[model samples]
Target: MKLIGLVRSIRALGEVAEQGSFSAAAGVLGLTQSAVSQHIAALERETGLRLVDRGTRPMALTEAGHVLVRHGRTINARLEAAEQELAEIAGHRAGRLRFGSFPTALTTFVPAALGRLRTEHPTIVLTVVDDHMQGLVPRLTDGGLDLAVVYDHEALPAATTGPLRRVHLFDDPYRVILPARHRLARRRTALSLADLADEDWVGGHSGSAWFRIVRHACRAAGFDPRIQLSSDDYRAVQAFVAAGLGVALIPGLGLVSPTAGVEVRRLRAGAPVRRISVAHLDDEGQPPGVRAMIAILVDVTSHLRRAEPRRS
Candidate 1:
């Protein structure tokens, strides 16, 4: 008469009959032993059948209980097969790679990575989206993305809870951007954080991840940087540095071309590094396409490391 009652009874009955002990069944199910006993008692009461003989040493199940247990196992197995078959059809043999990434990686890191993947897997489809770490974490959890490339920094705001796994790739170091005429620029070598303590600085918008990285790196070198200008755009930061206004900390990940007159100097001490990682939800069994994309990503990083020396 009661569908919910019957389902619960079947599950409890299957557990108790399989383990041969109410206490063992309850432990496996994370329920109290009394709850398991109560479920069995309720089943017998509702069906007007004696399901278990409690006087037996290892609690013998009656004929009705044995029948229900056998049928219950079959039902559970069929349900599992249905779900797995659906997932395989939906995800398997799909040539698409749904990748999410932040801006810095988008500028260069991902493009270079994709170039390498193309040579080996030319027919594989790739879909890429750019979003902040805070925005991407939710989409990753909700199944909107297959993988995400992100930069981890201590000062950045944390995202809400999500089911995902992070695979660390590498650390991208930050360099100081200065005018071609700055005294440190004439030195023709990387300058230490201590060497720039008294220098004026151009920075990103207040409370931005880059701003925090610059602030912390400076403080770690025993001085607070003087911010003369603030803007979120890297080009804007470059413009400020080019005019001899101030120097700013820039990451090496995307620093390919010069900014007309802007120059870059490596910071010897407290050269802040941002961690790059790939994120994906832990599905029970991953699809082949997902596995291929992961392989491509790892290969890309390996190739870049072996290439010519990059500007710090």
Candidate 2:
């Protein structure tokens, strides 16, 4: 078989393995089902082995099929990397980047960095996905995103066991949000986590990462927080605090605009900080657009760090 035909057949086999059916793979590859069947059939003829078990429902890849598909995926990834490098070498600014970020970062420095990127690379297309670390990490690993802005709290560290290359962005310190008229709001000294042990806590949904972080911080201070209210929205959590519902711990990025009737205060000790970073696949070299965006993010965060309010 010709090299081009062999590559196409391998790609078709990989897609079939992923999509689980010839028709599905056909749709994904923008080819007719008959054409997809011919490609696989050609591969089977060239390999002298049955690559797929047609007797199974949703299709099943034979042992030979699995081996070829695995190698095919690696080949595809390398080809993609080569294409990106060649584009940069040829001075092609026109490309698309799939970027992901958590909600707070999306609302904070991400937009500024994206705007700067657009100004500098006018021909580059941008697609942004807003998701939590749980969603973003998997996407990065599976090549669903080119880059992501992710964070992990000090109380509960992020998983670091993957093929992810991360660049430290900045630390977003967690602060106590209190009702303006609450007694703790009047304290001249910074309050410890233990000081709010008895207060009703407004927190993230039960069993969520943020909720776990809050529980871990409180337990470290020798108390189990009595979380009476829950919300995933940082703004809503601030609202609950302002209404005197309960005190909550919110990160600095989430407090870009503190709700009215709320007081933001620093922790005297053991403040939980969210360490933000830009992450990408380790095997893929940073394309020009990705590198440019990362640099812009660092610049934007530097200005934010300087302008952050000093709450004590």
Candidate 3:
């Protein structure tokens, strides 16, 4: 039987016992008298017993009715508890959020968002996975993650299709990181990628969006970068650049706490810009916990953007 059928049957039985008449119970349940009578009849047919003593003026329950009414009370209590638990989850006071993020996000914005989530919803458990967009999107599609913090560096809006819903957070600009002694290192203002054509580079490892973005941008600038090393970790990338292995591109989010060895400067207009965003299955029928996590993420990113000093 459907769950709603059972719940309504139990509700009808309990109301009839409390109110002492089908009409009164129907009024109490906001159902028609015929509907209340039909529910009792259905329950009686299911249990193969007479539930009401029809001979009485104000109806009294039969032995079978009394027994079923007792079970109805227990079911009512359980249903109330379940409703309260759902309410807590809806309020973001309890439940879990399975979140996925890439490395730079893990190091920067993700942690900040997690901190805010903890403060606002201390009872909410979080399961975090670190993976690139290629790996994370599939997991999200398969229902493995409640949300994924992904970035689009190709200067295009996130695709809107299937179960995926993309919420654009911010445009994270990429910057040039080079050793202190490098030529053009003193150029704190916007610098062209073509200027680094003859420069060896430190790009991110394969299997990451950053790696592909760097490669594509350099090729667009009319030269293929001779990468000495590829490290997804920005700190390590900075370390390689500091040792004069090569210049590297680091996102502005990663520049929150710069490494000591390199001079971080803005890339010229039309440089690679990453759109940091949160992607999740369409939330139309999702649980409250998923919506709660998304709300917290939006709030955290908003505050960070407001607090940050805009650069030229």
Candidate 3's error at 311, in angstroms? 13
Per-residue lDDT of model 2, residues 43-155, tens digit only? 99999999999988889999999999877766665567577668767888467688999999999788889989999988777889998777888777766688899876645
RMSD of each: 14.0, 4.4, 16.5
Give each model's whole-structure lDDT. Answer: 0.76, 0.84, 0.77
lDDT comparison, 1 vs 2, better candidate: 2
C-alpha positional error of residue 311 in candidate 1 after TM-score superposition, expressed in Å? 18
Q: What pairs collide in candidate 2? A: none
Model 3: ten consecutive residues of lowest lDDT: 154-163
Full candidate order by lDDT, most accurate first: 2, 3, 1
TM-score-superior candidate, 1 or 2: 2
Across 160-183, the per-residue lDDT of candidate 3 in tens digits comes to 122478887777878888898898
- Give the distance in Å from residue 119's predicted Cα in candidate 1 to where it truly belongs: 5.5
Best by TM-score: 2
Best by lDDT: 2
**lDDT comparison, 2 vs 3, better candidate:** 2
